[model samples]
Target: MIPEPIPEPRDAESEAQPLDAYSQAVSAVARELTPRVASLRVRQRGREGSGSAVTFTADGFLLTNAHVVGGARGGQAAFADGTTTSFNVVGTDPLSDLAVVRADGDTPGPVTLGDSDGLVVGQLVVAVGNPLGLAGSVTAGVVSALGRSLPTRSGNAVRVIEDVIQTDAALNPGNSGGALADSRGHVVGINTAVAGIGLGLAVPINSTSRRIIGALMRDGRVRRAFLGLVANPVPVPAALRERLGQRDALRVADVVPASPAARAGLRRGDLVLTAGGVPVSQAQSLQRLMFAEAIGRPLQITVLRNGAMVDVIAEPTELDAEHA
Candidate 1:
């Protein structure tokens, strides 16, 4: 219960403290979410604009899906209180399906990012944003799944591994880049995209965003690490499973020449049966491994090439920074 307002405390020192506890609770939660409940507006050439939900950044930045706000010919943003303002694209990461947008003049307060790594399946979570242009909307759900692989708009698939929290929380189209929070309302993920039945995907902003956002704020771009190779993971069909004696493997689709994979002697058509002793079933299993690994550290890779198993180690390198 909120502490009753004892008619102005007699002590002058005590009078300095505000005593509306109930109001404090409501306002605190609102203050935590209001800045992140951003609106994304885009204008393409002469075409009349469009908008979506976004999140405000810690340092006057706005975050959203790259596709929604990155390539806009003209764009703007709206925060709480109907404050509308112009914006510019700082940088875009199509691979991760994330982008950093910036507004000039002044920006509202930012949201505190929560740890996505600690997100537990079935734990309480909240999706706070303006859905379908409705301002200040909050939807609640429990974490659904942890490791998941989501397809990307750039045709390169995105695999969220290790605490890639899933929730039945309804995330509509406009909810992209809005805050996905824990019960305490700390942001755990950015509402990026939605897919089949209760399965919405988001990019974990914990460590990745820490790096990207810093770079974007300073230079309008992020220097990201990339390993130029493609692995096609095919699940063993239920009927065919018995013959293989194992669940799955990554069938190497393509390898970019001079890439870490190529430089390390990894070949196309190799089946990645294991990664660091973890049995690989799908492409995401490997992608997840990559994301979890240190940027410059060599990874122990196990593959089946022409029915023979091979082991090799390769380090991940940075992706193009300016092109974003």
Candidate 2:
């Protein structure tokens, strides 16, 4: 009893000390995003599924995952404010794992979308979702990594969703399509998957994703240009690196027969320096250009072949969904 000294009485200031800067930031984000995120109950072919979604537009439009509403024509959305509404699927892009839906009733104001391209590793992030059917669940974590690729398949076509954000925030099955907000409460990523116990992944909100979302909202589908080729990033020659001011270039690993790259005389072992006047260092650099606007458009490419710079013009074709 003598060893257990009397403890000092806690004051108001001491009681408030537990809410530190990190706690305050996370709490603020939860307060801001909880109302905008909704718990979804979707019905597809008589099968019921549950997930989360976030409001991203003023007129009751919400953003979610393609897999969340798979084959669902419409569903119910329940928000944290105890309001529920019916919503219809506007469009879905499996290749990007993104879907847009419109609510039939009033909803909360949309969250501010932030550019995920500006995110750095170890930055604080807040995740708001309805995990395990618990509405308005919030978790705090940091961005563990960026530029992670997630492979997606639609029918027989396969593609990689580029520049995905990886985080340590706890995500469950029902957390799919929820908002992964920054410390400032801006929606930077759409939580899409629980990769492992301590790992989660999100679809980043960037220029490329914005283009896909716009296409989904407007055209009910996304159209992409296809240049059939496989490439790997390789270090540019020291001399070329100095002259071109770039450290890496894409090395053509394989060229599909009769495709745009092959038609343009691009062959394996060619080092691609630029495409459409933009430096080509990674697959995403070229993938970002493969949109509807680029289909059937002349794409100028510069490559290093046998130590000589070669220029070639290629007309990309619309990617067929069946074979993309």
Residue-wise C-alpha lDDT for candidate 1, range 238-261, written one tens digit per residue = 654586577766667667667777
RMSD per model, one decimal: 9.7, 4.4
TM per prediction: 0.65, 0.80
Model 2 per-residue lDDT at 242: 84
Q: Which ten residues in a row have the lowest lDDT in candidate 1?
A: 154-163
Name model 1 segments beyond 4 Å from true. 1-31, 45-59, 153-164, 228-300, 303-309, 313-324
Error of 1 at 305 (Å): 8.3
lDDT of 2 at 207: 85
lDDT of 2 by residue, 1-324 (tens): 458877999988878756889999999999999999999999878789989999999999999998898879889999987889999999987767899999999999999999987899999999999754577788889999776656555565655555578899998779999999999999999999887899999998988889999999999888878787677667899987888999988888777667788899999999989999999786568779888899999999999999999999999988775434
Worst 10 residues of 2 by lDDT: 152-161
Pairs clashing within candidate 2: none
| Best TM-score among the predictions, by candidate number | 2
